[model samples]
Target: MSRDEHRHIPTLKRELAEGKITRRDFLRYSSLLGLSAAAAYKFAGDITGVKFIPTARADMPKGGTLRVSMRCPTIADPHIFQWVYDSNITRQVVEYLTLTGHDNVTRPGLLEGWEASDDLMTWTLRVRPELKWHSGRDFVAEDVAWNLNRVLDPNTGSSVLGLMKGYMMNDAGDGLWDANAIEVVDGKTVQLNIKVPQIAVPEHLFHYPLPMIDPDENGVFGVGSNGNGAFELVEYVQNGKATLVARDDYYGDGPYLDRIEFVDLGDDPSATLSALSSGQVQGSYEGTIAQIDIYRGMPGVSVHEATTAKTGVARGQVDQAPFDDPRVRRAMRVAIDPPRCLELAHANSGAPGEHHHVCPVHPDYAVLPAIQRDPEAAMALLAEAGHPDGIDVEIACKGDPPWELAAVQTMVEQWKEANIRVNINLLPSADFWDVWDKVPFGFTSWTHRPLGFMVLGLAYRSGVPWNESHYANPEFDAVLTQAEGTLDLEARRELIRQLEVIMQEDGPITQPLWRSVYSAWSDKVVNFAHHPTSYIFGNTLGLNA
Candidate 1:
């Protein structure tokens, strides 16, 4: 076995033993690592005492239009998409180099396979051969190299730049872009020489914000959808609808549906629910927790749920007054009870958070002791911060996504006991995004990321564009850097422990719970599963009718 295979098999086994992955996931991952089917089945049987059987697809008939209701997608640019709704639309055309599954396993997508150096500083990617774009152009190593460079370029304003540039770009020169970081070697192979040792390179490639686009096309995606994905864009109308048809020459598995139509139901969740109820749409992008009961009662509708690391965070700008005091921030953390918030706001459908950004789903998450909620302690901290009479604050957040509003309301009521007065400023979703990062105190919705370090780097790193709190701590930043480069899981988790404590004690954000997200689709839809990250994978979905 190769060194990479040896390293991965043990990790997979450990994950399986810990109940993080199932026996089926073990077989799938082991086969991907070059283990034969018989060997993989035997290996799994020895561990779980269960026989592995492959499902026959001969009886499954496909060829129908699947309609889904979602928010209007504005920007067609793959790299600059800010919302999950927009990516859901663009993903039909473009594809990613890697795919992180619902189980949080990172698998090769466009690339046939990849190998990492011992130090994890270099990754050699082998692109799949005989793949052609929807435009009939060959997919090659240069396309991958071009997309990496584009993501690294500061001028592109790619959201992924925050997550990738620091590790992938060389800081020796101007530090804006590094041509040597991504090297194209021949037609089907490419290499990445990163500045730091990152074990989650493959998972990072599957970050929703960074889709692999056709290198020859112009920067934007709306001009034309010439991609290598299983679906080809027939038409796309921003704020209205989009239509896609299956590509006969797709390199990957079944794009079973003959066609797909995505209709924008506006920002209201009710519209989507109505569409699903009346069969106007076969599927809905995401349904709020409050709507789960309604979905359960509806006939011919299947409500799917995925326990995710996704959550909403209430943040106070550290650079601003009141919250600038660590005492005040700590007071806020202790004043609100996570369990109470989860029960009241989320209908007790999710796991409570510990005020730290890391989730239990993350492999490197450190298990810390529980923090008790103390109203008296919060009052004392406020007094120590020179707010003996209590402090009045305004929290800004979007009115949509019902759970955010529900969470904020619950926290506001809980804070009253601590002598903290809060006024809610509910803005429209569009209006809120305009000032989401600039608000003094606000709520930001976060999606599930494969790694804890990825979200921390994007949102907590000192001066990054998305750093809403404007929190700058030398010790936190240094620990984060070390944690990012550490490849050993145990050692990295040790560092994560420190980071978690620091955040709970002094960070500007208070996260109450990790959400249990829901989606509803027609009963006729087969193989349509809800992803933990809320990603829509239409290619694998089929309509039984």
Candidate 2:
């Protein structure tokens, strides 16, 4: 070995783990290689296995704070504490007791394992032994009980409650949509019972808004009162951002990174793209599919696109005079071109989804022929509906990105040839949802559900009562209900396929396009993935040098 900048011999010696390479041998070797005491110690440590470290010649460089950029400048307070989303970045900063695979399959997370009876009615949970909350409190079954009760409390007004209500045990279908009981036998064992046996119960436990909360009034975020995880929300600014530090005292696995910052970029995809390009943030969750090239083609970045895109669509009330007739809704549905939405409106990220709410990427999304744009058919329907001249209507939408404006503009232009005119009145985000309390004709992105069957709720069921477009039919709703518990995968899918056919023929919602997945990150991060809807591999991700 020559006394210079290289440690080729020691590197070889370390790799050999060969026979005795004493301190003198190491010292002599260091001297021959001109290694300083610090470098010598590093070499000796590597040789002795005292502080051995592996070479990282990959994207996964070690030990650095990852800068993240995302849309939704500020996620709601409750969402930050809970696993709900005002943003995708929320999952990276928080965790749930359970997680699902990309295929919407279920797996255990916080809880070690769970079991259910033959009928799948009663669920017994086994908590991991070393679980601890972010605040250093031992995570016990009490936290689980508290979390279940809190979400069910009408006052909390969690969106998940209504969604999870389908599992609670009920007599004669009475309490089917309410919490039956959650019994905590001890600090680690929990017995959860629903109204009846429902296979989906365990899967729904990790539903958004079910994040365990601290029961004490000491008012700590995810403290002893709640449960435990790797990253704890140490600080948060409403509509701004949040910062989380590693809980070195974490009970299970860990967040190898020292800290995580969720920098909110609001909902403007354009602004989000700017932040990613300008290096304001290393990665983001809020950017839309439109800006993929800007981030991926950059000097140091990699992009993994989702195979199936998420849907963004508009819906309307049918009980009213204008849309009461199926012909009226069909005319509007048949006239609009589906592909144009992704190009002109959504920035070409995703393809046009069928009239069905389920994405084509979804396992069970119906594969029936798409509804083609038929101006002739649209005109014929309008004439039958007593609107030979044309029908005019208004729509309500979040107006963020001015969705209503663009949607209405496009609809008006397209429908003009078919004798229908749409007046788009854009409303501010808050105002849009607020006005929905008094109005019903509007557009909305349906919630992502666990299965393709679940997506059926978007049009078949009243959806969320608050947003139902008065588009209900007893027959459609019954088929959806029957499909919910059939358990037979093939049967459920066939039923769903039939439902999509029925929707295209008579249902009121006009589902347009399924948007693609979009995210950006700096090379300083590793193990980043964009999820279908509920992102997994969140807390488990790490940062690199």
Candidate 3:
């Protein structure tokens, strides 16, 4: 190769490694410079490697009253509801276009199957013709299109809209609904014109935030239990309880339970755990590590653990003082002992937090070097950053879940070794989320997403609404965009590794642990499977009776 070409190769590799461009973009740009795809892919592979596989689960028996401690947080509105328990309730009444399993494989959920173009920009989904909604209306491609529009509706402010950006648009120039963004070619076929190339379209199709519902006569989505799920909403009492009855005409897989009841515990873990132990409820929708330990010793109760997207993250407002400097961020990361924090907080039930929030159980986990606790190094960095007398910062958090409070307490002690003094400010869960964006330093519990790209786009990528740290990096964004566009798994994995490294070095969030969320079930409850998504699969569960 010529000297000029050799010089450009490093830049191209860096772009691909950092996710500044997708494989397709790289190949297109490189061909002009006379580079081959084989050569380019080899260079990318040498940058990263795969080392983990997500554990998988199998089918369980179906039929029983699956009583859960958590209650319905919403009126089952797929677009507005944001909690896992809410999704667990809504999923039974409405099915997704795809089914993402514990293995992280996307299968046909509401749709028979789906296909995408080579560019990954266009997608075609085939709906099952024989399916019928709970309203006895035929399930069609338009229903799928309607739900996508619901999420894209700007006024509604759907949380998952970040994942569908570029692909979904208000093409009509009138309102949030757009016919062209999602086109119904026929009764059974729907085509999606994505804003950008997204190889994980099928996997994201099943995301709870993008719930597919049969539109009411007014064209509203998820208004009155109009879904094609295995179970039909029998009755819903907002914030109190929700009851669903199994549907005989259900088109998809098992909603094994005959009936499912969700009783709201009002964010009271004590009440929820008490109900589970006393047989008042068959299971608890969410169980912390402390709760699981208590249940493990209880007779006839089983604890199911799954690697979740749920993580305890320490976010710093990088736009503010101290954290505005990257050295301060790195200093805080190295000063805190993640392993000991995990031990103190969760009895080591979770893995130490890596540079990024992606869980170790994820298949796409790019094994970056572990961040070890180094007080001397941390102190040195702080000293160099002009904090010779050490630094004092106040952090906000909710004291529930027990572990979160314990984590903050332990972290304060660990950081003291580096002369960092932390002041703890505890708030209610509702209060914390309300003013989370305003807090300069705080601990917040983030729920799970099926893909690493999903969370990264929502919280880390610059300019996104949920980018808590307001972190912006052109190269990192480029890498993530390219990874989304490329179908090559290995290349995507390599891009994720680079993304993790970037976040590790300068990102504002100091993630200490990726906690394994659990569901505790009574012995009478049979075929209760654990899902990493943290949503309960009520349709597949069965009971001894």
Q: Candidate 1: minimum summed lDDT over ten consecutive residues — where?
A: 169-178
Candidate lDDT (C-alpha), each: 0.81, 0.59, 0.73
Write candidate 3's Cα lDDT for 39-157 as tens digits. 54456556544223322224455567878887565543566655566788788877787776664545567776666655666678888879888778888888887777766666665
Of candidates 2 and 1, the better by lDDT: 1
Candidate 1 wrong stretches, greater than 4 Å = 1-45, 50-56, 170-179
> For model 3, how big is the CA root-mean-square deviation?
8.8
Ranking by TM-score: 1, 3, 2
Question: How many residue pairs clash (N, CA or C atoms closer than 3 angstroms) in each of the candidate models, in the order given?
Answer: 0, 21, 12
> Candidate 2, after superposition: displacement of residue 386 in Å?
4.1
Give the candidate order by descending lDDT. 1, 3, 2
Better of 1 and 2 by TM-score: 1
Best by TM-score: 1
Tens digits of lDDT, candidate 2, 211-275: 55556632234212233556655566655766766656665444567777767666566776676
Which residue segments of model 2 deviate by more than 4 Å?
1-62, 72-94, 153-156, 169-187, 195-197, 217-227, 319-321, 346-349, 398-408, 433-438, 458-460, 463-471, 534-538
